[model samples]
Target: MSRVILFNKPYDVLSQFTDRNSPSPRATLSDYVQVPHVYPAGRLDRDSEGLLLLTDDGRLQARIADPKFKAPKTYLVQVEGIPDDNALAALRGGVSLKDGPTRPAEVERIDDPALWPRDPPIRVRLSIPDSWLRLTIREGRNRQVRRMTAAVGHPTLRLIRWRIADWTLADIAPGRWRDA
Candidate 1:
């Protein structure tokens, strides 16, 4: 059987095992995960945090990362401003992006989730209100959640990948991993 590992990627961490191309040292999977031969199934941007899957099996990686498979990924987003109803409706209807129109997404505003604090907390703007959102998308795109929210005029302040496919961050702590 192939080994699958679920990691709660911390912010500013590179998804790979090494930092070959950069001059300055950056934290990577090697800093956290010790299991060898496993590769990340999908990528989460260095600035974003939460659930990331790794496996020694290539086919399972493809199934999780490939757009054709349509594996759903859910995010908890903290936005710069409160999104109005029109913005929510527009997101639900799919907004046009530089690449193209995105697939319609399931989105709703939510209360702030009770979770571990980010090492470097997000910026707080007392003058401008911020809000939380639960967004689920079937396709994975480069920084799609951030871009999508920006398209609707509310920039993402922080983003966390709460779930992917049937797997979730659950009890995994920052920079920690668990076998599935």
Candidate 2:
């Protein structure tokens, strides 16, 4: 049987197992995991935090990573400004980023009750308030969520991926891994 590993990756950790020459020396997967053959199904940027899937089976990895499969990945985003109906609608309808136009996503404002504190908290501007948003997308483009939010004029202050398909970051702390 194929095995899947769910990892709650912390901020500033490299998704890969090795980073021989990183300047600031952020944590890598090798620091927390011992699984030999498993590899990350998809990548989250070093700045982003949350659930990441790893698998021993190459086919399973491809299935999860392929855009054609349209696996829904959800994120809890903290933005610099509260988004209005028009901005929310634009995100749901799709926005054009620098790379290309994104597909329509499931976007909404959310009252998050289980958010964790980051090691280095996001910068605060006393005048500009921060708001949380839930963004769900089927495609896994590079830095897509951050770019999309910027396109809509609400830059992402912090981003935490909450779910990927049926899997979630429930009860898992940062830098922790569990068998799925």
Q: Which candidate has the highest TM-score of all?
A: 1
User: How many pairs of residues collide in each model?
Assistant: 0, 0
lDDT of 2 by residue, 16-124 (tens): 9999886667688998889999999989999999999999999999998999999999999999899999999999999998778899999999885577899898899
Residues forming the 10-long window of minimal summed lDDT in candidate 2:
110-119
89-134: candidate 1 lDDT, tens digit per residue? 9999999999999999999999989988987999998999999999
Count of backbone collisions within predicted model 2: 0
Q: What is the Cα-based lDDT of residue 77 in candidate 2? A: 95
Let me know the TM-score candidate 1 reaches against the reference structure.
0.98
TM-score, every prediction: 0.98, 0.96
